[model samples]
Target: MCNKHLMVVLIILAFDLAVATDSGLETTQAGGGLENRPQRDVSCRNHQEYPHDNICCLSCPAGSYVKSACTSAHERGTCENCDFDTYTEHDNGLLQCLKCTKCRPDQEIVARCTNTQNTECQCKAGRFCAPDQACEICKKCTICKDDEVKVRNCTTISNTECKRQLSTSSNKSGAVAAVLVLIAGSTVIVAFLKRKKKFVGEQDSQNPSEMEKVVVDSGSGLSDEEMQNKLNGRLYDSPLLEQAQAVGQQALANKEKETKQGNSFTSTAHSSPASLPTLPSAPLPAPYPHPRPVSPSHPNTRDDDLPRKKLVPLNGDKSLTDCFSYFEEVDVHFHNRFFRRIGLNDNAIKNRENLQPEDRVHQLLNVWLEKVGMEASINDLIAALLHLNQRLSAENIIAKAISEGHFEYEGKQPRDESQL
Candidate 1:
């Protein structure tokens, strides 16, 4: 009964201590009630690593720190700096309302300071900080992490875009691009072929109107035999005949060229003939194969007295030159090829006297007449002939479109009234 009474008395004392708070709110009672203002203060003189101004307890600044209790109600000295992450702009009296730290420029915001003691922080949507972190500052988000793909771009606000290491559009675009390429290529090829054919035709065609005026007079039609005979007779005095003569004379020169070729080939074959097995006597390489010689015309049918000369100088050989029908020849050889095809048919054919593209070739005749060395005009028959001939000789040219006939000059034909 006496022990029970002691317990009740103890309960009453505990109740009284818990209430009637005048002991400056309250204090941890160690030995007695209302003990001399709790003399043992937490010493913070040595704890100075962070919050330089804040130690055990003191007032933190306004716009900066938080109230985490004071070291004493009486002057316990000024507050030290807040926790490393916490801030106090200036004097905050006894209350230390801390300032929230901003994330660094390269980082994003995590948790904002709040009313509760358990403040939560998180990296902005795409960012993250490692564990054991207060997250006073957050870091930038990771770019594409998948190794197979790479980050193509990272916009200021948008998420980082990942691109395939290889080209993704290749498969689909390849076919379409191929088709477009084929069309373009085919167009180019067709144009090229047409140009080539036109060129060949220019080179080979005989513009009949150039050399001979089509005197569609009140004339009569001649027989085929007469025409054939006339043609055959004309062949005796043709440019072909002149060329043949030149060739015959140049045979020795041609032979020399062949000899030169053989010599060069032999020399080229042996970088150093030391590589060859040395015999007691050396042997020469074989010469290039020569074309088989053609037989001369049958004696009975041959021209018994055709003039022949090694050097037929073209100075004033009226006989050799007059043999060329200059007036008729240029007309027959150039007009149809160059002028007519280029949309100047009627006028170009009619004005078949001069071959002049523009300036240079036009003045060649003058140059030749004056014995001047240079050709002034590029429009002349020879120049046009050269240009067209080069085009015709290309790898992909047509011959038929360029050529009209091998000038087997049949003498004459009467024009029908219907032709007019």
Candidate 2:
């Protein structure tokens, strides 16, 4: 019994060794399914694909084109599509690397839009055939008056046609053609009338053979008087309406003729009759030297033909330096000037006007500060002066600033408006 137990234990040890060997083989062998070359973290994602996913370029197939390019070599944006007008073939490994169709001058297309395919093409219904022109549709034929020339012919895709009657031939040929047309029209009318009558009256009573004769013969099936009456009615009853229509038609034909001649040499779009005329362009505005200042207070009026009055630069007067004194003394000087203008009485002026020269004096100081490029430091005073009348005397502003404790305007080594 002891020997048997020893053999059993040895067998168990051998089985365990075989199992470990098999696991090792599976890990390193190619046929081991997951047998490895290298190991990596499964949670790690590719960083280059931040915005886009699935980073492989697919090839383009034949007969279609790409309209757009991929955002990057890795990130594919939506593909631009092609219609019947364009074509592409080949495994375009991209959404946007497609092709547009090559259309002949006379050809046009109707398309079904798509991202990855070519649209379809068919002949336009109204287009005329052009030799060497790959046309999808034919344009309708234009009808012109006998004396008219076709300045521009219509194509199947477009409705515009130009025609004009340059001159009429004076001869019997024109009259003959007109007469023949009238006679043919009258005959058709008479025949229709006769057929109607015969179908209603004689056919009701006659045998089939006799009814056939009735159907064939009549005074053109209508009386001569009836034909004349219809013609007269058309000519006399609607003359005004017909004349107006004819005039309008003539005007349109003339305009179309002119347009065609114009476009033969020049290629461009014309907006409309009311569009502004194309004149020689003025010189471009330069960025520097500044633009003209549009003053709010304009003089009363001027005449178109009168010579323009130029504004000579108002250079600061040399004496303006002495005139910079402000506050009490400055006030006394401008006070005399204001009353002199107002006829010495406040009642002479408007009811609520401020008579104190100091009010505007401080404003002027601000302007002077701003002119010297110190506006950022004294913007408030400058702004106030901007609203005041330009005619206000300068001395008054100094007085107001001094009295208001804004500055000492009395005796100072300062430059006048000119010197400053």
Candidate 3:
């Protein structure tokens, strides 16, 4: 019975060992399957990438788009060039390039789109928008009110700035003080006139001949002939003389009116006219100091006269300065040439190079004005434009000057007298 129990134990041990060996073979087969399958949750270097079949594929460089995914790890995908009007700004794993931005009607293109970079745009002339703010649309530039003055012109990234005008109040105060001074002066003059009349009457009663020998109250000691001449001069310069002149002018106007009436009545009664109204002679054209030279390009321009119209300032020097803003319309390509033609030196123009085109034009113009002093005129600027064959800009500036009341065509007055 002991020998039978030992045989049974040996058989059971062999069976247990065989079962453990089959289980080990199955585990080995499962481990081999895992090695052949694609990786999951794999780590990749920090760059641009895309996942394909549980594997990370490196992205294409800028200006390109991924055409295909990599077949294996540690490899890049196929890439193709971006089409026109499309761009990829940086290394991207995108299947297609991004579409380029289009500038709005109110905006202008600053930089065109390329495969490597997107388009850049900004507000056009006379408009602005802040970059930090949500720029749904560009805004119209602010025009300063009459009671305000422009501090800075509008730029693409900033709007126009204005400040309250200070000169208006100062002018009002000065006018009020001037009126008060005039009133006080009139009072003193009236008192002196009364006292002089009384003294003259007392002197005349004493002796008519001795009146000439008496010293005059005038600050200067003078001979009899000199005092008589001074008295005659005062009478000629007095308000009474002005009143007499006004009366004479009024009588002349009435006589002219009567003459017109007579002429009208005579013309009504007779076939022949009594008198024809005298026509005023035409005014001769004013001569320009430096006439614009006739050019082959401008066949219509006359050698005797400049093709451009002459601009007469409405408010003298102030009008010339006021029209300085119009010069900002000058073409950027012709800036240096235009200014140089206007007599600005190279150093003067170079110094203002850092300023914006508009501000640079203004500074260079101001420098030219200072150098020319009272001789500065808009005509000089216009002539310079003509010299440079920039007639269109010259004409536009003249139109703006006339339209804005800063200037007018010679011999032609603006219909609105208040503007003058």
| Number of the top TM-score candidate | 3
In model 3, the runs with Cα more than 4 Å from the true position are 1-40, 165-173, 177-420
Q: Which pairs of residues have clashing backbones in candidate 3?
A: none
Q: Rank the models by lDDT, top first.
A: 3, 2, 1
Which tens-of-lDDT digit does each residue in 216-301 have in candidate 2?
22233334433443443333333333334444556567567667768632343354544423321222222223211222143221
| lDDT for each residue of candidate 3 in 1-420, tens digit (9 for 90 to 100) | 999999999999999878766554233246456333324446666657777766778888999999998999768989999999999988877899999999999999999999999999999887899989989899998866656767998898899898987867888997987787677667657766775676577545632221112223442334444455445444434443344445555656756875778856556647644443332122222332333234435534432235444678889799999999999988887899888877889888775664689989888999999999989989888877765556668778877888888988777844442211
Query: What is the alpha-carbon lDDT for the whole of candidate 3?
Result: 0.71
The alpha-carbon deviation from the true structure for residue 31 of candidate 1, after best TM-score superposition, in angstroms, is 11
Candidates in order have lDDT scores of: 0.39, 0.40, 0.71
Q: Per-residue lDDT for 1-420 in model 1, tens only?
A: 999999999999998776655433434567665443422333443322122232354334433343354444323344445554455444444345444555555554445644222234445554555556565555454354333354543332444456546656876697787787677667656765675555446436532111111111121233343344334444433443344444444654655665777866557647756543222121222221331112235222222122211112233333222322222333334435544322343543433233333322233333333442342221232233333332222111112111322121113233122211
Model 1, residue 110: C-alpha shift (Å): 15
TM-score of 3: 0.39
